[model samples]
Structure formats: C-alpha cells, structure tokens
Target: MNTYLHSVSLDREKCTGCTTCLRHCPTEAIRVKDGCAVINPDRCIDCGECIRVCPQKAKHVVCSKFSDMEKFKWRIALPAPTLYGQFEELDDIDYCLQGLLDMGFDEVYEVSQAAEIVSEYTRLLLKTEGIKKPVISSACPVIARLIALRFPYLKDNLLPLLPPMEIAAKKAVERALKEHPELKREDIGVCFISPCPAKASYVKNGFGDYKSNVDLVVSISDIYFQLINSMKREITPVPFSRSGVIGISWATSGGEATAIFNDKYLAADGIENVIKMLDQIENGMIPQLEFIELNACTGGCVGGVMTVENPFIAKARLQTLRRYLPVSQNFLDENERYVPTDCFFGEVPHYKPISRLSNNIGESMRMMADIQRLREELPGTDCGSCGAPTCRAFAEDVVKGQASLDACIIKTARSKCEGCKNNNEG
Candidate 1:
C-alpha cells in the first residue's frame, strides 16, 4: 500500500454529509460513508477541489502557521508567482514581496526566478532529447500525482525536472549560506508561500525519491489579510525585482508553454479538461504536438483554492503585471549557464486499479456481468442522492459490496409505491 501525506482533510463536525465534493472530485477519491465524507488517500491528488466546492466549509488544507518561522534562526520566504495576482490595483510586485519581510520573514525570494531557470532547462531538454512526443509539464504537483494515479500510462511523458518551488528553496538556502557564514545549515529554514494544498503536500512528501528542500508550506489564503495590512503600511518598496516578465507570467494558464516558445504545444487548465486531453494523447491522437502544459486548477495558480481573488480577476491582474515588466534581457539566451543539472525526476509509483471488480479474472468477469444487470435495474438518473457521483458509479459500488441497492432513493421510492399498490389490491 502506498501511503502519502495529504494536505487536504475534512472536519467531520462541520460536514453535513452532502455530496457536493463527491461530484466535483476529478479522481473520485471521496465517498460519503456513515453520514460523513471519507477521503481515500491513495486516490486523492490533493488538488483542493473538494476544498473549493465544500458548502459547509468542512474541507480544509493543512498548512504551517506564522509561528513555525520561530523554529529556525534564519527564515527565508519563497513566494509563488501567483501571490502578485491576489492584490488588486497593485503596481509593483516588490510591495507584496516586502510584505513577507514585514510578516516576520528574514528574507524573501521569488519563485519566478527559479521558474525562469527551469524554463531554460526545459527548452534545452526538448531540443536535445528524443524521448517522447507531447512532453507534459511536471510543474504542477497535482497534475503529476493525477498521472500517477489515473493516467499511469502517461508517466513517461512527465518532464524530468524539479519543480520551480524546489529549485527556489535550494537556491535560497545556498544563497543564505554563502552570504551569512555564521549561520549553520540547520539553522536556516526555507518556507514556501503556496497557492494550493497540492504544493503543500509536495513539500511534505516530495516527488519521487528526492527530499524536499523546503521546510514549511504556508497557504496564500492563510496570510492574505496580514499581507494586505502589511502592504498598506509599506514605507519603501524593494529597489529591484529579480524575476522577468516571462517568469511572472507563469501565474496564469498557457504561461509556461508561451515562455518556452513552443509552437506545437497544447496548454490545458482544469482537471476535467486535462483528463480529456490525456485520453486523446493516450490514444495517440495528438502525436503532432510537441508539449502539453496541464495545470490542475482552471486558470493555473490563480485558480487555486487558497487564492483570495476570483480566477478571472486574478488572471487579469497577472497580465497587467506582466505588461509592466521590462522585456526580459535573458529570454532565450543560449549562453546562459545557470541551469541546475543535478535536478532530475525519479519513477512515480504505479497506482493499483482499485476500480477492478475482482482480483481473479474469472471473478472479475462474473462481477462485471452482475454490475451490468444491477445498472439495468436502477434508474439512470445521476442525481447523486445515493452519495455516488453517478448512477453507474452507484451500481459499481453496490457490486463491490461498498453500498446497498436500497441506498438508491429512487429505487426505495418506487418500491414504496409498489408496496402501496399491492396493499390496495389485497
């Protein structure tokens, strides 16, 4: 059994056992059992979709508090590029970066700089490598996990590179050690300001065999108010910005593909749309495409559940911020040699086909026949009143012995009506 540290969780007290999250979950990781929502850790990609759709606000993402910064002698804050999108009418990105310092972080580093470096390496890899067509971006941890869980066949297509957050953490620690000779390596903590719970889970359980460089994961929503208050009282903004327009544009959809200047690439946002594209890729329908950028959230990081602003509004702010940036001096410089060669991806664990009816081939065949019979008996309406996403899913659950046929409200109502008619005839 593969166990992962998931950041998304449910508070049973606040849960009304509503099926809202069940229908919205892209991977079908959620199920309502015993009048409460249960999350299957193996199937969960931690995209934070459940958090977004939960009506009772029972779903929450586990994140580090401001007090966690006190553990280390030197704390460094690594803010995601999407942080700039949360504030409306903000002209300079420096004000938001400075807010982290005001919020007790000793130093602040932009993850966008690392994004630029990763973009450079990705372009080079695409040019030299002959691995496969439609190289998928591994920048989004949720998408990487989704591939591991549901689209295991596409695992080889995942980009073999560390995400920008990890690179930024590594760079931040290295810079801190070099500038402050007295500080021990253990004394420094690299914390990430995350836009989603998937990134928080990645910080806890790193991708593949690599250990995470980041020590803490802070949700953008957790400190949004504090940062806003801090920005209001900003005395002087930072003199210079480290990231360029290409790097900062990564907050919105299609930004990565645009940054790499890939002409035959497809940029997909939203988990459902990504699944559809992956299905096509699996069927070899898009062999002509060179790359596919998939973000689990609808509008990239701006659509993350932890973000404060609406996705469309945030995307607009990001575009405005991008236009304000000067043309990048090192957009696609061939001579730039700052790429991190040590960064490499390891094999992702294969997911078990849990939806399989049975372990034995003969039993599975029989179960499939039984499931078809049961499906025919039940109403086709996918009202989700039975706590399953669809009528077909409910039938599957019944065959698997996870649910009863009586759990279907439509069936129960019809049975009650039949009983009344029989009594009248008697």
Candidate 2:
C-alpha cells in the first residue's frame, strides 16, 4: 500500500522546463530542476493539470492498451459518459456502445447507468441520521486524493460509496460469470474507458481497503478514432444504452448534485476554485449546504486531459444527446431505500497528508518556528530559480536536509552585498 503508481509521466526530451506546469499546478508538486520540470509524487494528487497545461506536450498519460484486453476470454468495456460527448452531431449513445463491441469488446457497460444507482444510494445516505453534514462526493478520484493529501480533516466527509466505474466493473464481472456458469473470475477482464489520469491512478491503486475490479484503464482519446470508424461501419446500434438523462448529465458539472433533488448542495469544478471553496468550508463558512460536489476537472469529467473534445463543446454535445432520454433509466427497487452494504468502500487509512509538517507535535512546532525565521530572511517573491515552488517550501526542504540555505539565490546575493558594504566601511 505504500507504493503509489501515477498515470502521467514527463517526456524529458519534449520538456523545456518553461515553468508553465509549475505555475498552473494546484498542489505545487512541480519544480524546475536541472533544466526540466520534476514532479514530486508525494505532493501530486494526479489532477492532470500539468498534463493539460504543458506547452510542449511533454506530459503523457499511460493508458491500458487494447492488447491487454485480449488476455481474458471475456472483455467488458465500461465507457464513461464523457465518451458520448466526443463525437459531433451524435444523437444516440448506442452508437458508442455498439462501437465498443465492434472494437473487440465482448460486453459494453455504461458507467452512467451505474451512476443512477449511486445517485439513489447518495440520496439514501444523506437522509440517514448521524452522517457527516456537507458530505463530499467521492465520484472524482482526483478530488478524493486531493482531500486525502491536503484536506485530511474532510476525510470523514467523503462519501463511502464506490464510484460508478468501480460499481459498474463489479456488476459487469458478476454478470459475465452468471451468464457463463463455466467461466472463472480470471476469465473476465473489466476495462474502464476513462477520461483522465486520475481515474487511471484509481484503477492502479485501489481505493481504501478494497482492490479494484477494473483490470485496465483505457483513455477516451486513445480509442476515439477507432470508435468513430466502428460506429460508421455499424448501421444499426441495437438501442442497448441503459443510461438516461440523469446518467448522461453526470458527465457535466452539477449533474450529480442536481439528481439528488437537493437544493442545499454545492457543485464546483476546477482545482483552484475547489481549493478556495474547501478552505472556506473548513472554516465553517458553508453550513447551509448538505453536500459538496467537487470535480478537479474544469467541466466535470469532460474537461479531463485524456479527452479529445473541448469541455464546453462536449458538454453541449451531451446536452443534445440527453434531449430524448428519460429522467433515469436505472433505479433501486421500489421497496428498497437502503444502499447495498457491498456498494460502500472500505475504511480509508489515515496517512499523514502533504500539509502535515511532522507527526511529533514538538518537531512540527520547531519546524514551523524555523520556517518562519527563514521566511523573513528569504525574498518573498515566488521565483522558481531555487528549484522550489515557494520560499516556505524551500525552507521546509532545508529543514528536512533535502536542500541548503545557499540555494536561495536572492538571500545569497543579499549576503554578498552586505559583506561588500562591511568591507568598504573597514
């Protein structure tokens, strides 16, 4: 569990160390070092902002290849609702569903269909007694990781339910096994067609105590061309899409919160805005809301770096596609009001977050004192020449023995000038 795998990597050859990613990163995980920008794994939440902002296209996502799907006898593709928004002038989602089959998948499952079930479960959880107020949606993997790293105080606020992708994967595998009695669990492969690197990281590192049922994560951009060709070749799509308007709406901002029929919910997208809102929430500013839906991507999942279409355009396309759909095609049984116990994820272990200075109160106090002292000595300007995101970060690095005080170029120059003045006076 200590080992963490990230989905995005830097192409050193393509990177110019231009500081574009450094300036835009929400977590301040990147720093220009040795003529290239390096990302610290401990600080990164896999928000894909670096990938989205890179000018040289140096940051690339590593998605599961189609060849990986061939390992199992039955391969199921769980397409994210964002996939439907990539095509222009599209009326039916069945085209995308059937295209996945044509592209070598034995089964096609829409994650949006499972979203309705999750939505119902969320409503039930909110109505229950003693639950945390202003509950946070665990739908976005990046948001979950961001909270775990920076806002550990909000851990209890996170919804314990498994995300739609995980739920769909578990259900898809179960259906495959039930339909084929002789098939073993190992014979089935669940591949999620993801829209971002955060989801890919989620599949790589399972959530909490539960290992993911999803075996592979394929990016939407990776197979967009093939799906387009496949849809063109298939005249009739068989009308097998099970998701409705509520499910499709999950691809855009405020979709989940709106579906819960709760006006006391706050839906915010983009990492910078979310951080500000979370800061306000931590200070007990937003007491009226019962739930907080935060998506790290700009326009929900549609704005992910792995998607081919523009977020606004994709959102508009999704709106057009939802015109003829029902409110919700999937729902819990009429008599069932409780969320299934199996749908809830395991308890997440509380590791020290990135903001945590030290586990020992005395040590943390001493570090803070030292950091404040250095903060006064160094220039307040947040220049990246020191290979640290901020002066405070460099101060911490020095305290931790990862950097030296001499690394502060401005301080060093100031000291040299002071020495020259003293010499002249002598």
Candidate 3:
C-alpha cells in the first residue's frame, strides 16, 4: 500500500543536518541532504524513535490540538493508562476527569477499563486456543507495525483482539448513549490523551480491520500539565472510583502481566530489549515464559517520547498511587464483556506489507543491479557516519541522487589507491 508516506515528516528548520537521528533510526528511513534531514515515508514504521532523539526539537508529531474538539456537542476524554502516572498528586481520578470537563469535555473514561477487559480476554485466549506459544500484545501500534515490517511470520501470533484504547473507545460510545439517550452519536466526540504520535495515526488511519474510533488525540504531556496547574487553584479533588493498583501500574512495563499472570512471564520495555526477545523467539530460543509483554517505550507507556516528565518520576508517582486504591478483582462482569465486536475487529488484511525492493520482482532485479553498481563505487566501511542509517542506505542515497558514492571511507580509500597506481604507471 506504500502507506509509509503518511507515517513521518521532518521539519527542515529543526534539523541541523546532523546524522544523530539517522544513526539511531531502526528502519534506515532518514537521510541528510543539503544540510537537512529527510524521512523516506515508505521506510518509516512511525516508531517515533526520531521524535525521542531529535536535539533541535525539529521533529514534531502531527496530531490534533485541544481546540479541535470544540465542534462536538458532547466531548469525551479517553485517557491512556499512562495518564495515571503523569501527575505527582492526582489523589483521585475524578480530578483529572473533572479538569477535562472544566476544559470542555462532558464525560471522561479510563482506557484502563478496556485494558482490564482485554487483559482478562487474553488470559482466556492463552488457555483456550493452544494455537501458539508466544502471543504478541497488540496494544502498541508501533510494535504491531514493526512486526508487520520486520517479523511478518509472527503476525498470526498476535492475539485476535484490538488494542485496549479501541476497546475503551467503543465502550465509551456505548455507555455515553445509554446514560444520555438525548445525546446524538454525532454530538459526542472522543479524544484520547495520547502518549505517542503513533496512537494518533492509528486512529486517523485504520489498521488491521480497525476504523477510526477516536475522534482526536491530545498528547499527555500537553493536557496533563495544563490540568496540574488548573488543580492548584481549585484545591477540590473530584472523587471517582479507582481501577485498582494493577491498572494504574499498567502505565509501566509488565503491569499487564501482573494484572493477568501472577508469575512466570516476561515484560520487555524499550526497543532494544524487545528486539532481542523477538530475535530469540524467531530463532526458537523462546524461554519457558508463559507470555511476553512488549512496550517499545523505555518504561512502558509512561516513558513515551511525548511525555514531559521523565519516566522514572512517572514510575514513582504510579507506585505511590497504589497506596490509595484497593486490589479489586481482576475479572470484569459478563455485561462488561459485551463488546461491540463489529467495531473492534473486522476483516483481515489480505496482503502482508513487503519491502520496496521485494514488491516487484523485475524492479527488485533492477534495484539489485543498481545497488551492485553503487556498492562497487561505494565506501565499504559501513560507517553510519554519512547520516543515512546504513552503508546500503548510503548506496540507495547515491542511486537516488541524494548522496555521492565517494562519501564512503572504503570507497575513498580505494579511489585514492587507484589514483596512486595511475600516478606510478605515468
């Protein structure tokens, strides 16, 4: 589908032509040219790695602003579990919810409710199907896209369930109508307090049979900070029931495993650790762990690049939150399980996403030929020093007319030696 073009963007003003982001990019999507960094949309997985590493703040997530919600008659705030960890003294969930209402929302829903529902649902999946050993969590859209890109073989292993946020969004719409029959479907707008840009994109672009359930996405760092300052003046904490310590903890890695499995599981946060585990699983070295929970962010949702506070601070805040809430029963009532299955999961994708070179056999062959020609002229050093993510990417850069093949140390060395030999012959 060549959907990557919609995945990333670069601000020329913020980029200093430094190769720092290129070196860290996992997909080899970024390249420096004419003192600016440009992203190849087809290559980007929309992982937000560059968003986290950019020094000039040149990189920004394309998401809806708070004012975008003004059109809806009834506004709903769908906060991510990470939202629980954002504030230092969010004694009650109601304060945050009320703050949203004060800002303009009519109602607020906890994304963790859906997280709980899916957690319990997944536990049943583990016991029933016996289909596959390591069922990947579909909560992180970036991780899901990465699997589609780098690990297509594991696609079948993803539990046949929508992400928690989607589940919550559906439940919110249903509950909203039930509580307020006067509210029209069009009248209500749902805005997710997003922890990353990927979620915003997920809602904008349907993924794996999913439609746009969320109407808007407000970055957590943006909304919560404003609420915190708002809280100082009011001094009145809005009281609401808690979703329990485990649900609050779900903001961190392995929180889901704790909510479901008591022990004998692996919770991997951070891309590096998750990649190692995926590699082990692919190589048939998957340990005896019952399940693996992977979050691409460093410290689960709280560590998302879009966050303002450091993840460590968020983790500490989340732990203290546990002191106030009771350990409620993990299972949801049967009525709560009545999800709008139609809205959650639909038709499966027929074609798996393939690499550009592999998309067309004839084109691939020509690209291979061109790559070979560039390789002969390319510097063989493989130093990501040229700001193209890799040596092969540098070759592709040359082929694309964005880079010179002589930029490679090895290629330059060989060119110099050839010149010396010619001089000797003369």
Candidate 4:
C-alpha cells in the first residue's frame, strides 16, 4: 500500500479510452485496459503529462486540501516562486506573502530564498574537483525520478543538492523550532504552495534516501480564489519577501541555468524535449557542457498544469517583478567556501532500473528479440489504438504477456491475427 502514492488520478467514468494520455505520458505509464486508462505504478513519475493531454479532463491531481494544515500546531507556508507570477499588475511580492498569512498560515517562507542558496551552493559544486561535468539540475523532482527509471546511466551527472522546496522546508522547520521551543518536530506543518502536482508526489514518495520535509503540497489553482481575496483585503502589505532576481528567475526555463553564471550549460523544457535531450546526452551526441537544466513542464514551474495564467504570461510577469529587485538577496558568508555537510543527501538506494524486462541477461535479451519480432508483424504506425503509446511499446506488452497480439486492431482487421494462425493455416 505504501509503495505507490501517485498524485495523478484517472476518473474512469470520464475516460473514453481515447488513448490521448497513453501517447502523451513520458514514461508510458498509462494503458487502456477494458476501455479505461490504467496507470502503472512503477513507470509513473507523476510529471502531470497525462493531466495536460487528457481530453476528457479525466486525469487530475490528488493534492492536499487546505484543511489538512490543521493537523499540526504551527502551519507554515512555503510558496514556490511560480506563485508570484499568477497575479497581473503585481508590483510587489509582499502582497502574495501577506495573503498566505491571512489565509491561516502562521509563517510564510519563500522557496525562492532557498533557491538562491541552492544556486550559490551549486556554483561551488561546479568548481569542485572530480565532480561530474554537465551536472544535471536535480531541482525538478520529475527529472530526478525519470533519470532513475529510464536514464540511470546519467544518475552520476545529477547534482547532489537538495532542491529549493526541500531546503525551504528544512529552513522553515529550524525557524519554527527556534521561535517556539515548546513545539515538537511533528507539531509543525509546512505547506508548500506548489504549481506542480509532481511536487506533491515527491512529498509522498521521497527521492533516494532523503525524505521531504514538506508536510503538504497544495496547488495554486486549488487555493487561487481564496488567496486573491486575501490579497485584495490588504492595501499595505508587510515586507516579508527575501528573494531577488536570482531566486525568482527559477520560475522559467533557462532561469536556473543562467543563475549558474556559466556559459557551458544546456536548458530545455517540456517532457518530450527533455527526453530528447537526455537521449542525446546518453548517446554523447551533444557538445561537452558543464551543466544541464531540464524542466518536465514547458516553461518550468509556471507551465505547470495547476498554474492559473499561461506560462508565457506568467514568465513575463516574473520578469517585470524581478526588474525592481536586486541580483540576489541571499548569499553564503564570506568565511564559507564549501556547502555544509547537511546540504547533500546520501546516495540513491531505491533505483533498481524498472525498465528492464528481466533480471537475467539471457532472458532479457530473449524478451528484446521477441519484442522486436512482434514489432515486425505489427503495423509501424504509432496510432495508440492498441492501448499502448507506440507499436514498439505494444510489442513489449505482448511479449511480456500483459497484452494479446489480437489487441492490435489493424493487424486483426487485415486478417493478420497471430492467435488464429493454426485455423488460418489449416
């Protein structure tokens, strides 16, 4: 029961077996079984790709409700930088921070502040000797999980640093404890105002050996009306925003990469484009760069399905907001040269390469051969009619006995059904 805690859910009643989600799913996690889309627990990285492509709106996030924050004594809000761009004509970031306080949060902490810290630490890591070149940003939880599932070889290239959300949660916890010594660790609740459902899934199923410090991940779309209403009440908001251009810039694609202040880096957004870039990296087809930053969403967090505004509009708003701010507001002390010992987690322990057909090399090779042979028999058109995304994927399903060869509508329609071979030959 604890193995899979996916945030994306499919409403079978709404699903018409259109196969839209099956094709859009980056991990091929969706499969139409019995006229309803079913998500495979192992392959799903909770990137919200299916949610974006589902025509019937059958796919939705199973995020934390606003009332869930009442579980603890202190409720702290950790607003991602993407939240700042949701408003139009927003001259100040404090308006949003104060609104969170009015919405029942005991304290408000900017995830962007932590992002600045991450950027600083990342800069230090880049100069460190023996560290892998082309250090892939681990900021996106979806990218990290995708690497573990499909691109395990690139695991070494992953930057060994806690993302802004995690860092913000950790810092907020420390602040809460310092202010109130009577409160226990579990007594404090950290609610992250997120633009992505993948953040919620990350909280549920932690990456590698380190667990997320965030208690709840509530989407911006879920609490949009309430927050806007709260913002309207405050004419003069208190100054609480500690983030600057470098921090807020993390909202869009190439933002984090630019913060590195390094020229040798590649940045791409959208799951499909990200997958393509990762493939190029795996095959060593790209130029030798120092860092690779990828976002599963088109325009990074702003392009998240849960966002209120269009990604381009949000990005433009963020740019305008950053103009009034400094380059950075958070920085390590002059005495500090290296990131503290606590910044990085232990090595990944859970990644076992779930994409492999079998544990044994011989059996895996045999399965691959069978899958290739089945691919030859089936139509090459990737119509997604067989409940699988592509013909190759359908072939894999048939070889694994999870699907029938007769499931291919084209093959069966053309009198090429392998199941009826004996009858046809006789």
Candidate 5:
C-alpha cells in the first residue's frame, strides 16, 4: 500500500455481501470477509472495475460532485464525446448544452476540440520522434497504466500527449475568463463528465503533479440515470441537435481513426483484443500500421464499466444521431480562428516515467528463486480461491512484494495441516 501511485477509496456503508467485485477482479485484489469487501492495496490496480460492477451503488469515485458546481459563478461542462452517445433523444448539441445550464452550469464545451489538437500534435510527433514504428495514444489513462504495468517494453512507443479532457478543460477555462475580463478565475469551475474512473483518478492524482483544469469528473453511468430522473421532474429536456458526427463517433472503436486516418491506423477495444494487438505489434508482426488507438473497454468509452445503459443501445442511439448531424469540419475553421496563446501545461508538474523493471536485478533474481521454491510447495490449482490467478502467479506476486506467503491457499492449507498434526501428536 505504501508504494501505491494512485488514489483508492471504499465506502463500507454502501457495500452488500455480494461477491461481484471479487469474481471479476483481474488482480484478485478484493476479498469478502465479515460480510464486507476488503481491497489488498498492493494488488489493486485502481481500474474502477469494482465501482463499475457494484450493484448496491455503495461504491463511489472520489471527486467533486455535481452539487459542487454551485460554488462557481460561471461553470462549464466539458462533456466527453462518449457522453453524446449515452442519450437517445438528444438530437441537437445545443440541447445538451442547455441541459447542462438547466442543471446549473453556465456554459458547455466539447472535449473533441482537444482531440483535434491532439490529433494534429500526434501527427507531428509521429513524423519526427526517433522512437517506435506505431505510437500508442495516451488518451485512455487505463490503457496507459496497463501498458506501464504489464508491458513496460512498449513505453517508448506510447505517444507522450495529454488526453483530450485535460487539454479541453484548460482551454475552456482560460477562454471563458479571457472573454469576460471582469470574471474571476476562482469563480469558475470546469467539470468533465468522465467515461471512466481512470479519468477521474488522473485528475485526482494531479496527472504528473499538475493541478487539473477539470474541477470535477462524474462517471457517465452515474450521470445517465441522474440526468434522466432530473429531466423527468423538470418537465423540459434541454433541446439538443447533432454534435459533429466524428466527435459523437468517439464513443466507439475506430472513432478517432474515422475522424483522422483510415487504413494506416489500427483501432481495437476491450482489454483482451488490445493485449493481442500489442503482442503482435511488439513482436514486429504488424509494423505496416503507422498508428494505434486502444480503449481498455470494448466499444470504446460507451462500453466503459461505469455506464448503465447497454452499449448496444447506446451505439444504436449514437448512429441514429450521427445521421442527423453535420461533419466536425463545420466548427474546425472557427477553432483555428482563435488560437490558444498560453501554454497551460507550463504551470503543471512534470512526471517521471516509472519503469516496472526490478531495481535490484540480483535481488529480484533471488526473490524469483524464492518464489519458485515456494511454488513447489503449492497445489498448482488455478481455482482463484487463493485470491490469485495461479500458483506461479502467486509466486510472482510474492516476489514483487504484492502478496504474502499466506495469500496462497495451498500453502496456507499445508501449513495449517502440519500445525494441526504436530499439535495432536504433542
């Protein structure tokens, strides 16, 4: 827990005795005991999958909530492009803006503009950087974190660019304050409706130690039901038309690709598919591809763990909406007219990349030897009853200081049986 690089929280009050979180956890980081879920910090990835699956609504992300918007004199909502897909009847982009105003926000902005900026910057980086052949997008923090943890070899290949949310949040705030010279910076709050927990976590942790332009980040799922219920009572849904077809399209796989490139790019979603793609690319099997877009969740942000509506339904709704919308290029010219002069990133903290390689190679080798020694003492049953994938993986966890020897069920049982036999003989 001491070496944990991110934020993690649990609401014991909201937890039920359900084992939903324990079953789906990739790292076996959770355990149910005394009718409550306990997270093993060393093993937890802070993926927010637990928050995604928790049925009791007890799980909560740590951030400024919607009510916090009340403090700002002028507020803007930076709706992730994924957000447009969450609603079926939203036919106009302005309607979505009006809805945010009705909810108490003073203005609304699109993160997709930031995506446009990132896209341009990405092309430049690709052409000049003396790095890997196919550079990965750092937009999805979950995907970035996963690469940092499981596949450090690909670190050089990842494009070192901030995600659209950060870029959009800063641009919106600075533009708003500049447009109204009388407005105080302290009086404005910029909130992003996040599609995933990693986005929220990125803001909370101060991505690379920079104070995020985004003041609040609410999950798309939480906002979905809450917005619907609020709209029912308000008697008027904000009038909405089409967001750019390409921007709204960001909610699904191949979305960014559709906006920018075609065949030279590769788009894949879901952890399984992404991993397979990374493997093939890493092994020099797919060098022909120039760019890669990966979303840790299937169906892109719409398929994030936090969403409530089915991805299928959302995708259908988005497609229906896209048909009625104009292309993104309509707004592109206006965006170019007003150039961002200040470098907001200059004010933020710079982060050093944390490599996963063991610092003490000899020590790690010895630890691995000890782990193998202990694995020989295990049952080799991959039942996951021991809170790990397999005995060998459990051994690696021990080597990594992520789990204790007792965390292995087979080892624990053997120790317990030996103790019982000795006690009885004595």
Candidate 6:
C-alpha cells in the first residue's frame, strides 16, 4: 500500500533472492527480505545500478511505453545526446532525428542543443561572485539525489541550473505553441527518449519547486530496435546538424568540464569515483577547483545501462562524430537568444538530512551511542551473508529496529555453539 515514485523496480517473480544488487547498491536502498530484493523508495536514486548487475534480469526500469504516445495529438521526441552514440558509422545527426519521426513522433528535438544553452549559462554563473567553491553540475539526477541522501550538507555546491533534457523539453513545447496556435498544450506530449531510469523519475517527480516540462519518457533500449529498423530504410532528413561539438560532447565523460572554458575543474565519472571526489571536496582537499562535473555512469551518459552499444565504442563514435562538423559559436550565441525569460533552474530546496535517527536531540544522541556500541561488538568483516553491506550498517539497522543482532552470521554461529556447550553440561 506504500506508494512512491520509483523508476527502478524489482520483478519479485523473477528474483532469485541473490545478494548481487544488495552488495552493489550505492545508497543501501535495496535489502534482501522475504526471499526478494525490497527497494526502499526514499533511499533509491534510480541510478539503474541493480539493472546492470542482476544476473536474473529481475531489476527493470519503469518507463512510458510506445503505446502511451497515442493519447497525444502532437508527439515530440526529445532525444538525449547519448542516443547519437548508439548507432555505428552514423554520418549525419538528422538521420537519427528523422528516424525518430519514422518511429511515429510528429517532430524531434535534440537535447544537445539544450546542452549548449546550459553550458553557456554555466559559464555565466561561474563568473558571478559569492557562489560556493567547486560548484557541482546538476545534470545527473542520480548524483543530485546521492548528495541529497548521503551528503545533505553539500547541497549548496550543486549548480542551480536546469539540466539539458528539461530545458530542451521547455524549448520544444514553446516552439510547438508558437508554430501551431490551434492546438492545446494538453494535446501535445513531450516525450524524452531517456538513457536511464533516473531521468524518467525526474520527469515524473521534478526536483525543487518547478514542474517538469516533459510529459512522458521512454527508455532508449526499448526503442533501440525500432529506431535501428527505421534507420535501415532512408527517409527525408530534417537538417538537424545545428548543435555544436561542445554540446554533443556532453554525452561522454569529461565533456561538460571540457565545454567550460578557462576554469579549474575536476571531471569524475562513475558513482563510486564521484563519491570519493565528493568526500575529498567535503574535506577541503581540492580547494583550487572552481567546478566539478560528475556523471553517474562510467563513460557519462554513453555508458547508461539502457543503451545497447558498449560505452567505449559509443564514446569513440561520439569523438569521431565531432570531427565531421566545425565548432560553431553560433549555437552558443543562439542558446542565449532562445532560452526562456525566466531562470531555467528554479529554486532548489536543501536536502533533508538522512541520518536523523530521532526528533529529540537526546534520543538521537543515545541512538548514535548505541549504534557505535553495537558496531564495536560485531565483527568488522563486511561479508554480505547478513544481507547488509558492512558490519557498521548492520549495527545501524539493528538500532533502527529493522534488523536483529543475531542476523550477523558470525554472532549467530557463536550463539549456537554456546547453546550446544550449555546443553552438554546440563
């Protein structure tokens, strides 16, 4: 009966109750209980980590289907920049846009074009004074959520700018309204062809006060076969090569950092590496840097689990694709002209602290003390047999009443041996 908007879901029927997802989860959101992986919705960031690791293919991303597009009179496809990397030897970007139209979309808009706009705004924001040191990119929803869950104190470091996808959706809707005045906004559906579940969740439940412009979202892998089949047969191209290399480069790792000119920045990819960098940032280790670009996936969006192609190959393809077109300052300038008058990124609320053990200060302190005492008693080995990632985590779970002290296999075995000795003496 507990309802929460989550992009990543577990298929209980298919789940083997294997601890693969439990061990790999970055947020400790998943727990193996009742012979199935149960996801804690508040803790889940929808990074799709479990989807990639699940051997039984029990983990899946929930997204809008192709059939869902039928409800809208005007269907616009907003393809993520990573979608370009999926096709092999793709000569023109228009070929891909046209292919989306072939997939039954009335129109197509490139998210890379929006990335150019965001990049410009990022540059402008960096120049302004009084902002926090090492401003983090808010492009990755998973990274933003990770900070909210684990590092709430560092929420001010997040760049207060709308991600490229949302900006693109806004622009697409604006154009739709301008071109076709007869149609109602409700009649038009803005669909984002997303590479990850995080984006899909973002569309459904937006960050902060702003509502999402994107009406629906479809996974890249779901439509990969259809797009491939469409691309096999030639169609009229829409001359969609206006977006520059800097914008297109956002699909790969270090691309965002590269786009920002003449600034000391750190570019980190993969969630674990991002977490490490965040820890260093928190400790004031890297004080000289002005910005940090963090991507949840290994090779940025190209490495998203939904994509069919290998991340390295896709990154190489993106690099090659960049060479074909000349770098254009026009796109950068156009970004300034085309953006909405209101600020793209609305006000973001500070993330609520996740470690608040209790409302009363005294009780919370007591809980922490108990957790520490429990941790000292348990073996430090982080063996996953207890269904918790680490001994400390298991101790915390015990204090929270979600787990028992006997759940620790080492403690359970020792207790059993002690009981046997007492029985023999009796």
**Residue pairs in candidate 3 whose N, alpha carbon or C atoms collide under 3 angstroms:** 4-41, 14-58, 379-411
Clash counts for all predictions: 0, 0, 3, 0, 7, 0
Over the stretch 147-197, how does candidate 1's per-residue lDDT look in tens digits? 877777889889988988988898899899999999998999898988999
What is the RMSD of candidate 5? 4.5
- Cα lDDT tens digits, model 4, 1-426, are 227588999888999998888888888888898899999988988899888888899999999988899888999999999999999888899999998898899999899999999999999999999998889999898898889889999999999998999999999999999999999989999999999988998898776778889999999998888988889644888787999999999999998999999999989999999999999999999998999999999989999988899999999999999999999999888988689888896765365566799989999999999999989988899888889999999999999999998889999887745557867788
Of 2 and 5, the candidate ahead on lDDT is: 2
How do the predictions measure up, each by TM-score? 0.92, 0.97, 0.89, 0.96, 0.81, 0.94
Q: Model 6 residue 197 lDDT?
A: 90
* Regions of candidate 1 where Cα sits further than 4 Å from its true position: 232-234, 329-339, 353-363, 413-426
The order of the candidates by lDDT, greatest first, is 4, 2, 1, 6, 3, 5
What's the distance in Å from true for residue 275, model 2?
Answer: 0.8
| 65-139 per-residue lDDT for model 3 (tens digits) | 888899998889888878767777766766776677777778888887667777777776677656576777777
Candidate 6, 334-359: lDDT as tens digits: 43544354545665644444577787
Model 3 lDDT, residue 110, Cα: 83
56, model 5: CA deviation in Å? 6.0
Per-model CA lDDT versus the true structure: 0.85, 0.89, 0.75, 0.90, 0.69, 0.84
Indicate which candidate wins on TM-score. 2
Worst 10 residues of 4 by lDDT: 345-354
Q: Candidate 2's residue-wise lDDT over 132-199, tens digit each?
A: 88899999988888888888888899999999999999899989999999889998899999999999
Q: After superposition, how far is residue 97 of candidate 2 from its true place, in Å?
A: 0.7
For residues 1-426, what per-residue lDDT tens digits would candidate 5 score against the true structure? Answer: 134445446789878757677776655667665567777654555677777678886666665567777788898888887776677676555555566666777777788667766665565556664757687877777776667566667876776666778888877888898898888888888889877777877787655445677877777766666665444433554544324676677778887766555468889987768878877876888858777899877788888766676887888888887787667633435445432433223322222223222568787678778878978877877665555546776676767776677766667788899999999999
Pairs that clash in candidate 6: none
